[model samples]
Target: MDIDNIAAKAAAKIDAVRDARVNAVKTAAASSVELQEAVQLLAAAEQKYAKDYQAALRADWTESDLRGFGLDAPSKKAGGRPKGARTRQSKPANDAASEKELIGTTSENW
Candidate 1:
């Protein structure tokens, strides 16, 4: 009920929130790294599969022969944001030019 006790309680709450934010940020960064590794692995596997399929074709593989191995020798869809996914708003095209043209800009401009 005293001022010192109230201040201490508020400080404790703030510290708890700060710790939670730090943990959340760390978790997000770790997840991002894992996602990147997974994407790279997927790309490598796709590339290897394509190379193997091409080698099979060079060895005189027919469509039926490739199908027997459960692979279709055809062009594939490019990797990108999923269909119907909302697009992120990009910065205005002139943002860089405007920034450079700003009067008396310094390192602290941001």
Candidate 2:
């Protein structure tokens, strides 16, 4: 009922909220580390599977035979630039000359 008692109750509530937020952040960080480890394991397993598949092919196992047994060929992993990667376009050899011509400035002026 008093101002001091009311302030104390509000402070306690705020502290509880802050503690919950901190715990949530800690939980997310722990989950992220676990996910990263799992992803690494998955990539290693995929690489090993691809290698074994290639070996089977080299040992005279035809793709059709593998498919007949329900074992499809390993998919090719994307190897080129990542999505949204910026690439610089090569300028033409006469780019400067074209620019000068567009601005009506001849080589004699320089």
Candidate 3:
């Protein structure tokens, strides 16, 4: 065969390989996006189901029933300071004058 024919055949083969690679990559990227969306949807559904299940349990059972299952009753607040936080009482006006007399004037002296 002529050099021109051989060169044309090789070029065609290279183009075919490149087109196949591009298609494969596009397919994989599309599939990855679809899979990610599905995963997120599944996670949301699982969370909703868990919350609904807890509400159902609360409606059907008493606090003692949960304790029997080795679960503590859900706290009024999830995770924060208790209702009545203990605060230090401020010094009284009379005590403030006496404090300065007992303790030195400056913090360094105290």
Tens-place lDDT digits, model 3, residues 1-110: 69999999999999999999999999999999999999999777666655554675769976578678775644332333566889999999899998987676566675
Alpha-carbon runs more than 4 Å astray in model 2: 77-110
Task: Compose the digit string of candidate 2's lDDT tens values, residues 32-80.
Answer: 9999999999887777777777788889999898889887777754233
Tell me which residue pairs clash in candidate 2: none
RMSD of each: 21.6, 11.0, 8.4
Per-model TM-score versus the true fold: 0.62, 0.61, 0.54
Q: Model 2: what TM-score?
A: 0.61
> Model 1 — which ten-residue stretch has the worst lDDT?
74-83
RMSD in Å for model 3: 8.4
Shift of residue 18 alpha carbon in model 2, Å: 0.7
lDDT of 2: 0.83
